[model samples]
Target: MREGFITYKGRNIVFTDYHTHTNNSFDSKAIMMETCQKALENGVEQICFTEHFTLNPNIPTYGHMKWEKYREDIQTCQEAFKNQPLHILKGIELCEPHKYTEEYKQLFQKEHIDFILGSVHNIKDIGLRKTLAKYSRLEAYDLYFKEMLLLVEKADIDCLAHFDLIKRYSKEAFSQDDFEKFEPLIKKILSKAIERGIGIEINTSTVEALQEPMPSHYILTLYRELGGRILTIGSDSHYSEHIGRGIKEAYALAKECGFTEVSIFENRCATFVSI
Candidate 1:
């Protein structure tokens, strides 16, 4: 698969990870500068620190982010690496933007974030971590996909992060048959993303830990078959050591699935880089 990488004037294509977390996020412990150095060493030309900033009232991490300090830290890294080849970008991974419309609108009004990743972390107000045991298997899958469709249609984001993340925590093991049942909703979500100019993130954090990335290989292929062109690869790393894990494989998989380019964002606009 690595042999299929398209070159630009004899230069190998480098990658940009638009989704990552830092110590500013309640769940991560990665120091900003250390992560930058690690990413640069791993051949990531551009890296965006998308710290978790959620508005969900039910979650403990809500309102816990220190936005000013987070932005300051990113600026420090950007300046520190100014002369280097690695480009540091500031971003936020907003959980469930469709559920927090007012907060989403108000934050974007003042925050000068370079990238915004819209993700659905819960189903019907119950977080995914605790949701599996509360509902029937069928009900859980239904609610999850339904919310994803709504997010794709209503959330104003540059890309959808971890489109099918519930599988990572579900009580039932996911199977190809299960994904086949979800094909219709999946297609709708992909179609809406394409129409809205939003890209899909291939979250590689799951690959090292869970044996596959979020949304599975079948879903990635289906996205390409459905004419969805925009894609991004993210390690979703909470630690510096995991900075570039599984990203090369994610890019190769995208190339195999017929995606010639991966999307990167700046000030909410997408720029495509060939894989």
Candidate 2:
């Protein structure tokens, strides 16, 4: 890591972890300002706080976010780091955006946002971790993909975060290498993403436990082969100490997946930056 810029094919790879949550989110206990400070110290230049935004009242994320506070917190971090190279992006991780059209539209009218991350953390009002356990690996993954496909097709989002998160609770019922059965659905999702100009987020939090990103390396390659251009990486950290845990490896993996540039967002528009 030369000057903290890892060399890959004569280029320095600088990373931005775009998937993060803090005290503003229901499941997180991290203070936003502290998380930003720690993440920057850990070699991450850009930290996007994509706090979970869910409409399902049964889930923890529902009715939990204090929009004004979350916004003010990011603004404060920006002012504090104004002279530094640190960049803070305000984003929301929308759970099932497809199902809340009116509410989703209203978010834009009332709040200023930089990015929207779509995700499927549950099925039939139940968290995937609990819902997935009730079925065989294939059956469980199939259900997850179906919901994910629906999200891709109908949701108002920039990209899908933690695309293959179903494996987090698989309990060894399926191996990461055995995703051949889900190729068709994966391809469809990738195609739709490319068509919609929505990028794919390679969530690296799993690398600490599963030794790879959420969607796996194979899915990443497939995404590149399908002419997908936009890509984003995240650590999915909820605590300050976990801020940059698997960030470097994620960029290395993206390079291996043939992406020389990655996408960053502001005001709902994307800008590409070199790896």
Candidate 3:
């Protein structure tokens, strides 16, 4: 088991990482059950298998799992680890909500998903990673924010994942001025998210690996200022070693933002943990 980030209320808080990818996600290499086993071995009390669910036809890396096969694999994993102390919750990481809202609703209605993470990984038909490689950093950031606003308003999902993930791959340095330019749009997205009862995620994986936490400090502060209450933290770990890597820092940041608690989901309901 990995010994990491045990601080919370002066006690060891065993975390349930809610954003994880397995082979079911096209770009992931680890199998579902293997990922769960690693989590259990790493002292993770619980985890959600939030594999990618994408609708960008241009990106073949978009999820390719059939519903029947996906469910079968999840059930198989659940049963394989049933005797363990760790809990595995069924989840999906939704990408490009504006383009795939109907598909998402259909998938959710057709299956039993314990958690859903809404993310904007694309601007129109292009993936963020690809966009960063081809366009100017400012151009990519603007498109990302614009598309994110659309996702916040249109997607029917639980939590917004890595609110400013596009900035993670930027070729240029981000500044306070850049954040200032996007502040109004950020507030609007947060306001709509609050109105829709959608939760925001403090994705630690961004900082742990990508070197920039999503939503950035300014955006997170704005969310708090707008009276937003529900917030969840995720490692967004694609590999076992990265699980729970920066959660302690995220919790500290949340506390500084005036958040008294962090959120977790089970059976489609949110439960709070004191920060």
Candidate 4:
């Protein structure tokens, strides 16, 4: 066994970096093979390339992904790593799936992916960063979770990505977490996620840049208290060097939050493995 590697009967992925992107994503240019090689170098056993995918005609991500090309690269990566420890999963990180239910419906009618991470990259059609300029940091965060609650309530998503993603765009104004201040709303959001059988991701993408938890310690504790067991850890890497970054730290944090296993998905079904 690989040192520090968690195994699931030597057949299932152990949940390494599930939120990942590559050239297929609108905002990233990392090559697929490079990401795989980098994950292998970092001792990552598996990675799901959840490239940014959206159908908003008003956004840059609309029609940006060449699905055919992306599938080819995944095939190539799987073949190249067929003899190695790395297992690449096909996934898509969707923006506001609840807002584009019909589009998502059409998508699922033809395509089936292993995972989908639902995120609110924008609020009311405005970018999170732009919202900070129009509202107080606290206001922006409240709006963020409120919009996120919509997805948790309606989207056919496996998990919610970055519960406090607004913090990523509002750090300039406030470097602290405000989970307590928004506890009621957050409780509704988390409870809805559990009720809908949706999971959440501990996005470690900001561990180096922001030095903060994605959901804060409070959010993790709340999920546990609510009996939420389905969670995954991801680096949310957009570049090669970002692959597998902060994964060990996220695993430790999960353990501290009273979680023994992290989840992985295949054909959209979750399988938990010891972290």
The candidate that achieves the highest TM-score relative to the unseen native structure: 4
Q: What TM-score does candidate 3 get on C-alpha atoms?
A: 0.87
lDDT of 2 by residue, 227-257 (tens): 9887888889988999877877887888998
Candidate 3 Cα misplacement greater than 4 A, ranges: 1-13, 133-135
- Model 4 RMSD in angstroms: 4.3
Best by lDDT: 4
Worst 10 residues of 3 by lDDT: 1-10
lDDT tens digits by residue: candidate 4, 98-135? 88887787887688688899999988788988898899
| Candidate 4: worst-modelled 10 consecutive residues by lDDT | 1-10
What is residue 267's positional error in candidate 4, in angstroms? 0.4
Query: For residues 127-217, could you state the per-residue lDDT of candidate 1 as single tens digits?
Result: 8867778877667777888898998888777778998888888766666677678788888889888877777889997785568898688
Q: Which residue segments of model 2 deviate by more than 4 Å?
A: 1-13
Model 2 residue 67 lDDT?
84
Clash tally for model 2: 0
Candidate 4 wrong stretches, greater than 4 Å: 1-15, 171-177
All candidates' lDDT scores?
0.81, 0.82, 0.76, 0.84
Better of 2 and 3 by TM-score: 2
